[model samples]
Target: MSPSARRRQEAGGKTRPGSPRHFLRLDDLGSGEVETLLERAVALKAYRRTGVDHANLIRRVLGMIFEKPSTRTRVSFEAGIYQLGGHGMFLSPDDLQLGRGEPIGDTAEVVSRMVDGVMIRTFGHHRVEAFAAASYVPVINGLTDSYHPCQVLTDLFTWYEQRGSISGRTVAWIGDGNNMAHSWIKAAVLLGFELRLACPEGFEPDPAILEGGASHATVMRDPRAAAQGADIVTTDVWASMGQEAESDDRERAFGAYQVDSDLMAAAKPDALFMHCLPAHRGEEVTAEVLDGPQSVVWEEAENRMHAQKALMEMLLA
Candidate 1:
């Protein structure tokens, strides 16, 4: 077994043979499981394109609870589950008892009893952990303050779809060290890839998370240094959801960290540019680079559906 699996077992992560497999973090999955998910995602993408009827998730139901706003996360999972012969219900905070001060674990228990799986996009990572702890079905972290596991997993699947393997390739992260960056760090450690992050000093990813991947991850202030020779150059918005009040301040702090042409030029000529979108064209990236030939943001966005379909299938199994 992989070290991550061993750690999970030691922590009583899985209590029984038939227990649900929750994806609260990337490390919750073994490397081999990630590889399998990506492979299945590729097949599922092709199946969609070819108009093949793949209903592996027939009769399944997914409950998507959103404590925050979302576009990609919402549409992708709703459509993906429908395409897989299942139903997806969107539950806003006001739509459920959760809005009325019900505990997250109580809501999770009630909802999981009715659905095959639950996907949460929320503010606190601890909320998802609490929900998963009480859920009888699988729980997927759609996005959280500390980690955006689904998005990063989709990003890795996007990389795998383009290039065969990302094991030895370098990935440059040039923006805020928020949830996205933390997930990338976990991925680098588990998948044997090199991850270089460029963040304004105070915006660096969590120290404990960074330290865990010390063997394969490095932090620096220069976007150029991080992008230099990287196979994939990726970034996210300076101010993410719930950080709107800090937008002005973040804009000033992240002004020099934008992934513009000069930064892209520092990476290999064939390197791809990716952004987990709802992009600020003039902020974290420029119009030139975002709409350029190297940017695969659209495909990256589409892969969220394919990737999560594979994940849901695995967890529900």
Candidate 2:
């Protein structure tokens, strides 16, 4: 295994042949595995449309713990699990005793016993790691400050559904070096793609992750330069969740990085525009571009359900 894969497997936790696997980061799965999952996602999508009875996860239960509010993640996982003949139990801070200072390991141990798998959307990456360490069942990182693996996994499936292959393609990311960027960096390293990130001077992606994928990823200041000759151009909000306090400062810093018509012009003519939505029309991306022909944000959002179903099945298998 590669050094990055080895590190991810270690971080994801070791399991015996018949035990569960954890998806703490994108590198937790190898390149071939990622591709296979994407293919499965496509099959799942088709099966959903055909009204096929592919309830592979019958009688299973998924415990979803959310410290952060969500639109897509919550709905997708809950509905997806139900469609797969499983139950999704939503646990919020108000619902769980963890708000009253319950230990995460204790919560993990207790929860994993009842649920077939657990997914957590929290502030810190270490919280998910701690839970995975204590749990007997599979653990998935729904969203973390360090990496939003599922979002990138869904994004990859969206790209794959459209283009059939992403290897050797150019993916331009224009925004903060947040969790999405980190996951994209990991994806680039694993999938042999070129990733160009154009962020303001101080908003680059995590250095260690960037360095690990240095051969396939590049950081730059000019958005157009990064988008130049790109096949996929994507960006996120200027300020992510919990960073609302720095809204004004972030607005000032990222003003020039918006993915507008002019910016989209820099990429190839047939290039696709993508955003993990709840998008701001006049901010990070313009209304015309987001609602325009090249934009696939809506399809990308729906793919979240299909992609995650494939992931959950893999973990349970």
Candidate 3:
């Protein structure tokens, strides 16, 4: 057997024979798996809090490819691998032949031969899929225009740390209907939560993803309506990286949708606020709410490393 296949067998064949598991999206993990992951994140965090040692990924290597730049995604994954005693290799488009017309499959084959796993953050979700399909090692979707699953996984783990079970909680998502919103939709479906999204008239989340969480998700234009009695209130930037052209228009349209103290007050008294940074204090959310006691943005951000350490262990250890 190939090294990757032999490792999977040693890990107990958690997936079908001859197939490596890929965390390309949140739904890629079953609800039970989600719970386990969150729980693992908690345990890992606790272990670290007491100054324990964790080197599960010793001698392993993760290849991280970035087509889109990010502050948190890059730092968290690299730090996570290092903390777990593994090496993380960062590759940008300029550093790889794939940027100059090399086939994705060819690059995937070459990379997987040397690395234990790969993580990709790119414009198109399909690129990660193509990589996973071709590689012998496991793959992770760091981010895409379609979804940002790892960020949401860290959010869920943070929520679990602060509020315990999220299965019956209400999460309010205010602002743009972007990749983060899509990931939240998948999270609601998998984790059994109520997800209410507030977006402008033309900014609804992808219909297919909205449909996937039909039973537990709702969308409307009223931020107050969505935040009412919510257990967690979250949002992303009004315009993501590539949408700079629409910045002015989006700012106008999303002005009223901001998650300010007034809107946050509509949620439960102990509600936690979340934003996938780097946040524009006065744009998608107000300074008061983001910096308030109820905000867990920093902890939420830090959990990315811990949560992903568990994720990498699941796939590569």
Candidate 4:
């Protein structure tokens, strides 16, 4: 086995034999597996664009459970599954018996029997963990309070599509140190990409994340420092969906973290700007930067479908 694969096996969790399954976090995947997923995503995207039907994942069933409401997450997964000749069953919190007090274990076990895989977008990271624990089928963490592994995977694929490589490339993150920041750190560790994060002092990325295996990716107080010489500059909202109560406070705290022209100038001359939308204009990112020539936000959004299609194929095929 490759060193990365061996590391995954020794990590002490359920994994598919000869196939990496249950993508709960980027940290669980090795560089080789990430590359494989990315290569497959590229081919799938090309096929989709050319109107070639490549339904390698025919008849597979994916159960999507969403405790949190989303636009991109819902649309991309549903569309990707349909395009791959698979079916996706959407289960909102109210639609599931768990919402009416059924045990998570029972819900997981029941769903496992019916679905080829499960994708969950929810609040607590532990909910996804619990689902994975009881599931006989593959469980994918669509999003959680701590990480958004699927989105990060798509982000990396977008970068790879544009730059052709990830190793040694610098990616600067400017904004709230939330789930995206956490997943990006994990990606840096797993893919050997150099990541730099800039956030307000109190809002800096989870200390445990930076101090963990992702120490190679630096965290800084200065936004300029993070963006300096970076190949890609990325940012998310100052206040995420659940934190709407702290909107004013977040705006104050994240005042200096916007990815405007000033920040972009600190990066490489031709650096790409990325935002995991829906972006707040004049907040985490400026409208000018988001719509500018250097921005790849639209492509990044489009790649989410392709990247997730590859993930489904790998886990379900």
lDDT of candidate model 2 versus the reference: 0.92
Q: If scored against the real structure, what TM-score would every candidate get?
A: 0.94, 0.94, 0.94, 0.93
- Quote model 4's TM-score: 0.93
Comparing 2 and 4 by lDDT, which wins?
A: 2
lDDT of each: 0.91, 0.92, 0.90, 0.86
Clashes within 3 Å, all models in order: 0, 0, 0, 0
Question: Best candidate per lDDT, number?
Answer: 2
Error of 4 at 268 (Å): 0.4
Worst 10 residues of 1 by lDDT: 7-16
Candidate 4, residues 5-71, lDDT tens digits: the string is 4543554333445542688998777889889999999999999999998988788888999999888
**Candidate 2, residues 1-317: lDDT per residue as tens digits?**
76533433454333344446899999999999999999999999999999998899998999999999899999999999999999999999999889999999878867876778998999999999999977778999999999999999999999999998899999999999999999999999999999999999989998998899899999999999999999999999999999999999999999999999999999999999999988999999999999999999999999999999999999975
lDDT of 1: 0.91
Extract clashing residue pairs from model 4: none
The worst-scoring run of ten residues by lDDT in candidate 4 lies at 11-20
The positional error of residue 264 in candidate 4, measured at the CA in angstroms, is: 0.5
TM-score of 1: 0.94
TM-score of 2: 0.94
